[model samples]
Target chain A: MTSSDNTERLVHVPLGERAYDILIGPGLIGRAGGEISTRIKGRKAAIVTDEHVGALYLDPLMDSLQTDGIEAVSISLPPGEKTKSFDSLTKVCDVLLEARIERNDTVIALGGGVIGDLTGFAAGIVRRGVRFVQIPTSLLSQVDSSVGGKTGINTRHGKNLVGIFNQPDLVLADTDVLNTLSEREFRAGYAEVAKYGLIDKPDFFEWLENNWKEVFSGGAARIEAIATSCQAKADVVVADERENGRRALLNLGHTFGHALEAATEYDSRRLVHGEGVSIGMVLAHQFSARLNLASPDDAARVEAHLKAVGLPTRIDEIPGELPSTEFLMDAIAQDKKVKGGKLTFILTRGIGQSFVADDVPASEVISFLEEKRKK
Target chain B: MTSSDNTERLVHVPLGERAYDILIGPGLIGRAGGEISTRIKGRKAAIVTDEHVGALYLDPLMDSLQTDGIEAVSISLPPGEKTKSFDSLTKVCDVLLEARIERNDTVIALGGGVIGDLTGFAAGIVRRGVRFVQIPTSLLSQVDSSVGGKTGINTRHGKNLVGIFNQPDLVLADTDVLNTLSEREFRAGYAEVAKYGLIDKPDFFEWLENNWKEVFSGGAARIEAIATSCQAKADVVVADERENGRRALLNLGHTFGHALEAATEYDSRRLVHGEGVSIGMVLAHQFSARLNLASPDDAARVEAHLKAVGLPTRIDEIPGELPSTEFLMDAIAQDKKVKGGKLTFILTRGIGQSFVADDVPASEVISFLEEKRKK
Candidate 1:
């Protein structure tokens, strides 16, 4: 993995008139000001980051933005998923409005998924919408949430149930930031990187299986993984920006993943989002096998690769006592993906071959979960 | 307007794939379900309305929907601007998700602007987005809000600071519903109708001066007024859906109107949105005249016509003591239209000739308001 190779990868999300670019590189954070100035031109920026990320990379980002005479006012919040709440969104929006940011002015989201989502959503609704830039700091965000136009905050009901599809003008996926991530956090991000491969790219999945360690080491391998994941996402998102069909494929593991997160009451200490996806992806394969949609060997292969990467591949892998199968069933029923009370899962026919199975019988899912609880 | 003429006056909002028809006619409410069912096809419907409108029309709408085998569940809230709040939006979204409404399923907004704005925003964010229909009942909504894709709820910061521009699959503006509105409400709506002509249709404004009485009486005049206004809005919005350039012309009176509404604390009893716009429209003309952008004769004509139609055309017409000019100035600065601390107003050259005026000096606006306050 080399800086020269990684710096050249660019993923374009073609949204007709609203299209944008995702640049994957080793030093984009240091080059962000020049990168952003060309896109927005003469407009000021409001950089929104979390305290944790601010402590790590805010100064560098500010300095980079200043390089092109791009003066940016920065706001840092307490880090974590809880920070992506309506109150936080409101506070950010008021600051932007009070500052009288113009329609062309930029709002730079300079953290992971939480900051990216919260800031992007604010940018979308402020004065109806302003241009936004995403500088994702974590492997998970760089590979997933940052590329997609979906931005939102949590609600009393669930995660991301209330949000709009607000694409960013530019996404700077700087791989240099990944070095700051803890091993646990890095592995969580790997789950999503592995997701794109599992969704359709068998060759890519096989690649991750071989280079998983190199990716963790951070350099060319990590940048390639992020760029590949973003390109895969950009392709699906371009084809189905509103998630009518192919976009659902990107949520391959999210259905069961979301249910597990709900069961854990979203206590990241018990089970983080990427871990839920890791387990959910494995369950998706196992469920496919149970229904004769795929071979048991294929399911096992998927599970083994996740375990090799140290990701949770089963429900019991979660810490602490789990909720009842009925509770999990209720969570699945409550999933935003459920169309007309029927279960819809991105089930697989084989590795990297997924399809949206509309109206999968709920009774069947319940029975399968019951069997899995015993294991 | 006659049913035949009103039905014939369909305004097409052309936004590529998101384009939809706004049907303005008598008894469209009774035919809403059938009309909607034809477009969405085999989808369930969730009709979100207000108590006032629900008590009058929900059963008929439900029965109409059932006629086409489009089963619908309905929720009704208290009627007014207060209904358009984030808490109310959350309540509506939870209900739709709880009902397991699919992405393709339709959520019908079945009341005036408040319900339409609240429900459309809820539909926009729920599951990223869902198909929606707006059956606007009030004159204000019929001629204005329902035609455009501006869906939002008010916040502590300002009105519509938090929302998405989510267009509806269809909008049924039943002229029959206008009969239920009070004379004051009807007059308020007429202000917007007169607005389109003032914005760029001298002939249409001249026509309104002649037809104001008939428009209030409701028949051919009512439907024609609504449909024409929608067409004006459609033309502007289709050209600039995000209000970047040409669309700002649609806010001809809104900046001043919104400030006045804020001054009154949004007390509908003192001044409804339409009335606020009525005064604001008059103020806009006077300001233009004062700035030598337009003539005093043009300002007088605007005031005279509005007064004849029974809309408040002067600052003193607003009931109760007005806020200080400084307080009013704060509201204007906080306007979503203000870009980079510079006031952006739609100023007129003459009747049917308006242009976007960016960076208007705030001192000028304050002095203008001071003169108006004394009168």
Candidate 2:
């Protein structure tokens, strides 16, 4: 559901004492200091961002924090997925500790998922934990990473294999920041936005399907979509913060998406995270149809919507030489979703009707991927 | 109260779903696998130990796991406080992931506080968290660190400045392991045992004073002392696992102790943790008396008992030139117990009557340390 005012929307994640609010609107970044001061009493903040995001928004954020009498120090690392590593994590943590960011002080993630994840993990660990805030500059982080307390750094073993579930004290999803994103980057994030609807919000999916243009153009539709997506995620997180049960649903497209990302060696030039999710979601629906769990029409509809929004809906659309089905299968097996040698995939009956299907046959997945790769 | 069955004792930490058992007995290392298998369903185990502890116990522990049909791998790190570091944490996590230790699989810590804290932190972050067990070898670890799941690594900033409250599925405190400890190390650990009594159990403290030799000689009294200490710790941990309130009482001697340790640059030659704690606890009592909060007779009694056990009851006994009082006060101010520039120390009204003292004047602490240093 869209906000009544639509000027701004606040989604409160009710996680008992760890609960915080996500503010989605146009100028939250400029007012971040004011918003943060109201919730977190700390006067000191360490804003961790990548060079790209920091270049565009750091000055304003620092000024806004200064305006609210909050002393914030910004640490800008080189932009990219590679920055989410132990070296970067140590760097961020060392910087935070060196800054003497106390337990009650704030650590703000002023970039996208990489920054938010690394920053949150640092905030969680430094001094056992400190107050954290997220100023998500990307739609992907706004709807997903910033809302959940899941934070970590990737190791040579795998992505996000090291970290903790550290929730943020506040999240400022300023829609105006999306204007700085390239069209490709914007569309990539849109894949995750579309994912929220496919997970459980059928009406939201229908609304997005009809108003994709307005969301792309940026206005009330974008705010509503972000607000609705945040609320959906917030509900899931509140119910199961640790991913013991219902939280697995939020990984709807992540298993296959992660496998695809890994198969591509996480090369963003070939495919970014949201692009992989867009293709993976379609594959999930198609595989569900193959299993007779859903009609093929539903899969077609998902693919159509994603394609219309400029997201790659098929594995064949990806650039570069595709890995063999065995290679892809190996990657999938290595995903964190596997438990006791059994495959756990989020399948569906139709749109907005995803369910975690456990013990799915690997042979079927192999066969399905083999067929899809040929397309 | 000591266990009725003095041969072996069980202290259960009842933390709802996070609850676990602490088993104090002889030959627990040999029976480690049997104890682990019953509690954790996973068949794979990764035992993290230091060269010191691993040389003594790793073989028996591995053999036990193998006998139980649990696949086990051993990672023996260099023994020292230095092993509780980011480099070691990364190495351990990489090895665990490389071994494909899944979520349900157990990560067992088979050494003292350093190994337990580092391994527990790795187990906590790897795959978001994995099943953890602690087979604490040293008395300090068995009675204190092992019972409480406060896992962390020391940063350049301070000790235990980075970590999480990740409870273990089980703690196996094999009393036999203490037989291999140097008398100094054993006596050092005894300080924490004494601390449990000093916090709230006057009877336990009185019992220790009476049976000090029997407790150190390693038989029924030793097991009884360890069990009682674990129970006291378990009670506090169950009440406040996160150190929000009453748990601060558990740090009865830690604030000043940590300051002393920091002053000595954590040099074990000068002052190990337990020895520092011994001196710190005495100082705490003396400082309380100086504040007119406790009787001077109580401080004398504490000092006498600790001194009789060969523990240093005064900072002057640290076997080296100590730092200035101002330096120690700086370290204390930098401690995790400091909140909003206010000192929060565990002070006492008398024996077995420790309470969290907030906003204790810095002037009083400096004067107390100044007088103690001269003595």
Best-fitting candidate, scored by lDDT: 2
At residue A5, what lDDT does model 1 achieve? 53
Each candidate structure's count of clashing pairs: 4, 0
Model 1, residue A111: displacement in angstroms?
2.6
B1-375, model 2: which lDDT tens digit per residue? 544555788888889889899999999989988999898988999999988888888888999999999999989999998888889988999999998998899999999999999999999999989999999999999899988789999877777888888999999999988999999999999999999999999999999999999999988999999889999999998888777899899989999999989888888988999998999999999999999999999999999999999999988777777778889889999888888889999999999999998989999988888887777
For candidate 1, what is the DockQ?
0.55
Model 2 quality (TM-score)? 0.98
CA lDDT, candidate 1, residue B91: 83
Q: State the TM-score of candidate 1 restricted to chain B.
A: 0.97
Task: Give me the displacement of residue A73 in model 1, in angstroms.
Answer: 4.4
Per-residue C-alpha lDDT of model 1 across residues B31-55, encoded as one tens digit per residue: 8877887789646889899998899
lDDT of 1: 0.87
Cα lDDT listed for each candidate: 0.87, 0.90
